[model samples]
Target: MKLGKSVNFTTILLLMFNMLLTSCGKNDDGSGPSPIPEPGDGVVYLPVVVHVVHNGEGLGEGPNLSEQQILRQIEILNEDYRRKLGTRGFNDHPDGGDAQIEFVLAKKTPDGEQTNGINRIDASQENVPDLGYNQNHYAQYAYWNPEAYINIWTTPLPESSMCLALGNATGPKTDLPGTEHLSIPGPNDADGIMINWIHFGESNIDCHARFGRTLTHEMGHFLGLLHTWGSGDCETNDYCDDTPPVDEHVYGNVPFVGCAGEEVMIGNYMNYSHDEVMNIFTNDQIQRMHYVLKHHPGRNALLTSPAL
Candidate 1:
């Protein structure tokens, strides 16, 4: 996408120079400068176990996503997070960087039993309630240790909604001072992500958001990245220096110049853009996620947890 017509040539030249310096760091071996970890240094593997909550729905029906569909979502997460080379959304933007994170299906349950990493539950609560589905109620069907596995509950939204949200996730609670204890694996109801079945895969549900980007966006929140527009306006910051601050969320692929005269990063995963348009994650965002993996009590455990 065109960033903007107002970019200064001198600034671009300076950026290029900085990149050259970064790529030419001194090395004792004299073989050459070490490759800078623009994306990151080491890969962080996260184990995921998806809980398919279906209300007596058979395979390939309703919220009961088939195993293949679930695997497809996992593949998308790995591709997007790693920014795999030649991927459809891959770009050469200087600020954009691979997150160096991969999601794998767990091979064992928390109780040291063999499993396929998928838990199927036929619960009535899988059906959306009149007041919208309750995450805690849905989680009752199947919930593993949140510290070791990313729990994803897929279900349908209430039928009476004015608008449909593909998914929602609970942001990391580590920021709360008194709530630090609650960050660890426990019986907390608000610990995992709840996704609309249609948006979980490349299905023919919501065309605008059917390409599995909803989970990618929600995962950003689970890892502590805020909306690119912060809470509301351009005045508030999402805490990432590379993500340009916008007056508000940019939906679809619309070009929007922020108050600071910089073009808004509509393609950022954290934005409300459509699946096809949302792709890049700024370097600052990668750094923030790494910090969460290293420091957050609830999330740090996943870094070393064995997928098996």
Candidate 2:
């Protein structure tokens, strides 16, 4: 079945970029963390478990990410979520409030065997190409409890240049069997996260920069962050009012200059460029994430559970 007007992928890319560049200039300094809508008391803290599957290829040029590399990446996410990137100027908003989400590599396999939470599956499955999808057996063998654990599968990304991250949502079928596939390369509600190995290498100014943030970016999608440019119009906002309206998408590596005197936030994580300048989430982005956790079907329960 055709998916709408088959938004020309290129067009969608440009549109997202333009919107980001144009909105970069607006800076209402002191745009603090969004007020928590739900009471801070009963809110639950979610634990995250990552299932890192690799092709045995090194991090940049060759070999899979060493255990150290994997751990480092996870640390980055933890830091980003905690609003602490080490350096004060590392993030644009400066107010990178805590995401309230935490990830710890699982120590026990689903079968209760000792595990680093990093499952090293032989990257040799016909259906599971180099791009990913070999996680079925891992999740099956490990047996994800579904309600308790969120499995994040990491694998060498496909050489395909067009698609960076692919996310699947279970919608109302969160309880369906195979929901874990959305996180791995499986079919059901797996909620898989895919990242290109190239993003960890030297970045090209003409193309988006290479950074482990691809995983971070895709994770945002898994958490339900719409492109920062807002799908369309200011009304189509990323569900955040602080983010400015973007008309065009950023392409190649051009530093987005703010439009109409607004301070350009080329550093926003949702933009297309690979610049390190875009790191913080607007208060609205944070709210949207919280909104998903509180209102989305399986998310809240899963997040609040200890199995995560």
Candidate 3:
């Protein structure tokens, strides 16, 4: 894992300092991750519900993405999680491993009614052009019980014309080992994923989201994984031994010399690499996500949910 380059002490300090604002919690109040369970043989399925908030756009136009686009996004998620061959997710890297998890649109609503799990909300009629600066506004519009379903909200995060917003997710309440968890505690009812309308699903939007990696990347955050270089330090640890620690993010370059002299894992899904280059999740990262499901806040509740 040694890198083929020497380190510059002063440059490293700046990188570490810059990462302070982006550091998330390992726990809401600071706690270590539980001992990882032995990798299991079965698959883990979690029910998902998407809340698409558009600016009065008709279905399949603008922010109102077509049903097929949404489904394709889910399929892409499966490809990455299962490490399906013949797809972008498959990789022969020694550290790579299948997450053994899957996401499915919720089959039943919390009230016991049949559902496709897609909730469409027209924001213009309500006079709210975007959720841009109004964080959690979507929660007021529509929210499902976090215990039963993982809610995904998509809206125009852009305020006036220019739009570069991506997506974000909530981490578990309990911190994982070496975790500097989300700054905001609580796996609140508003828990789950929030994505921009333009870049969601199909990635056909005119942005860097040429692929649906934003969801997969944020999903890693939602589970408990950290950036490849935790908090942007060479001495930092993402708790995944396979993902070497570096001082800064690597885009498409492989074998970048890291802060600790190990080869940085530029291709890990948790890194901010280009969508086309990011793919595998290390064996350790998989274990960390699995740990969150069984031990972090309401994550365990999803295991027993009857939504599916």
Candidate 4:
């Protein structure tokens, strides 16, 4: 079912205003999220379906990564989200939070048939410049009900683009009013993360983003976390109080201090920093994600639906 545009717009504005007010308060030291949520709730499990699209390449070749590689990516996601001890980037920060979200590969299809959650498709539309269009085209080859499962498309992205991004995603549409039409089912339901195959797993390719943190970054977007700098300037907040506000994205290993002279959270998962240095989501980010999963339309169904 579609949402009324007017009602949706009003609701989103109200929610965003409330979030802004709630997140504006800072501690005496100028640290964020004045009052963080106490961690005691049960974990939220999300079923996942990975679509590996390749250019007629056989398994374990090109974009068609091995099943083991995909599993490794899932393991990385679990470690990042759950903050498992001994994981590469896990650390102890008072504001750093464990999202308490677990992602499991689907064991059953939408038709109730037992199968691995991985879908390998021999298609040539693997590399595209426009991520939204690419997801729509690839979904025609293989797609399940998006409401019940988190769909991740792994393919090669165009290397020639002037501005290269390891991955991109369509955040929850409920937050964008006029864009509700984009969520319609069929070939246009662009509601998942699209990652460059080379950046999918830790060992798939050797690049600056080889540590599998690209997916971690995109997953933050998928779960409604914006860049620490927000959409534009320091004035534009990401609705998280704990994160220091920067003027723009800080790429590579360059040290960045916030616009207001606060120490930037260079290691935040939402930043464009190198994978090895990117970790930790603030308490407010965790709260925002939990709110989306429980309150956003179509998203809430995943918590209860058995299909994937």
Candidate 5:
């Protein structure tokens, strides 16, 4: 479905506004060179497919988000994945962190077709309500060759649905590392990542006053970023040193003095608050993600011999 020019313009405005609200001005506190280790041979780009389920209830019947909004979300993810633009409350260099990993929207498919690496699917109530469509229903569309793409699904629902929707504001379940693998949450975490409207869209969690930062946070999860504050305990860590150690997830109002006495990188996109703060990924996190790409089943071929 095509959107009118006017609708497109409005979507852009909303996206920019939300970004401004969530983005932080650049700060050199963590200034340093990119720490991402060089790839082995070929350049690997992560291709992502976005699936927006309509629920077939039509607008307003469920979550009233539109296609324009969904597209805006994709655009936002691309920008964040490419460049680190800091804002008032966010910083790319909390302790002066630098990263080298980059993401380019795939220009060609494994078969060599022009592609931006994004897909959309509209599902009817062919399945149950909470059950919705099987993950495989949409997975098929994104499975064009898993060695080359990352798939993301977004949907709208009541407040309760948002809570049960897996990776909401709570972040990924870490205590049960294998738990994420056992039941596999929504369905087949190995296949793709699923995000909910209240948590997935370009909008931020109202409780957190964050705008559009959740995707940044979640995409970190997709790219193998753990919570900055570490898993469930203060001792356990996300492995990034630039980020100060904190006890747990920060949602809604940020603490004035917590964060284990370390200067809070509240504006980093990884932080909980959506305010114009926390924009940068630390050099350490960059290394971790780069390391993760080394093993992610979908990323192997891209690193060795890619279509590019």
Candidate 6:
């Protein structure tokens, strides 16, 4: 089930080339795929279990990410959540914020066995499609208790070319106050993220989204945040006052003025901006996430899970 060294990279190149044709079109924004959240202890610590679904390539190569790669990716997640001052996640924007949440690699399995926090799946041997449109193909392998951990499955997907499914989450039915009626579609049933393997960790993948920000972006969705322009155009709001209502999802790091005539938060992770330019999560967004993490039954469970 192992892929040759060139196959994965070459495929990634093909995907990037496809982006050029699709760039003119707006991203089909809004996320579902419900990866819930956690709370309490002043600084919430949620355990994470990353499942690397590969074609059976060696560790750290292809999709079988090595321990070091996985570790670094988790670090990126933390840096963004904590808004660490010296890292890419840091920002001085008046609206910027730290979610005050941290992702702890699961030190134990659902069955209570010690683990290094990564699960490797050989797609070929496991009877799972390596590349496909249906995300449920890997659901059968999801952790027994998904809400207890941030279950992230990383692998390439055919839908990547559509500028749609590079990274997705199982998001909760957000109950953040003032927007109690506003729901996050329906990844409501399951929890966790399914991201394109190439963008899950640090890599020289020859693309604008190689810095692992896709996961951070999707994680925002997982914790119940919405796109800055939920339905694109001036049609809807993301429920975060700090984020202006933009016309559509922003792609590159270009300047943009929203429907309200305010400069858009292009650096905000919730938008579809490129990885190199994305950073802030904003004060309003942080509050929404904290509310969801504090009240959602499933999300609260993660905070108490023995896995942490």
Q: Which ten residues in a row have the lowest lDDT in candidate 4?
A: 176-185
Report the lDDT tens digits of candidate 5 across residue range 1-308: 35566677779788779766555553445354333334433333555555555555565334545656656665555555444454232344444443433444455766777766544445554344343444454554345554555556655456775444534311233332322322233435335565666655445444443345556666676556766665545565556666666666765435444456765555555666543554567666665566656655445444432433
Candidate 1 lowest-lDDT run of ten: 176-185
- Over 1-308, each residue of candidate 2 has an lDDT whose tens digit, in order, gives 24359788897888789867766655555354433335123334554555544555544333254566667767766665555757322464544545655566666555667667666554543243232344443444233565555666544555564245432222222332222323322354344444444443233423444445565666566666766555444454454556665545654445554434454456566666453554666666675666666665556666545443
TM-score list, all predictions: 0.78, 0.63, 0.80, 0.77, 0.62, 0.79
Descending-TM-score candidate ranking = 3, 6, 1, 4, 2, 5
Residues 44-148, candidate 3, lDDT per residue (tens digit)? 888898888888777998778899988988888989989999988899998898899889999998889998988888877765344343336677767898888
Candidate 6 per-residue C-alpha lDDT over 164-275 given as tens digits, one digit per residue, 9 for 90 to 100: 4577776776445334323343453445678887677777766788888988988887788888877554745777777877867677888687796788878989877887
Indicate which candidate wins on TM-score.
3
**lDDT score, candidate 2:** 0.52
lDDT of 1 by residue, 168-229 (tens): 77766555322231223345454788787778877665368878888998888888788787
Model 6: what TM-score?
0.79
lDDT of each: 0.76, 0.52, 0.75, 0.75, 0.52, 0.75
Per-prediction CA RMSD (Å): 16.1, 20.8, 20.2, 15.8, 15.6, 20.0
Off by over 4 Å in 2: 1-45, 55-63, 88-96, 125-146, 157-189, 200-208, 251-263, 304-308
In model 3, the runs with Cα more than 4 Å from the true position are 1-39, 127-135, 158-163, 187-189, 204-206, 252-255
User: Who wins the lDDT comparison?
Assistant: 1
Residue pair clashes in candidate 1: none
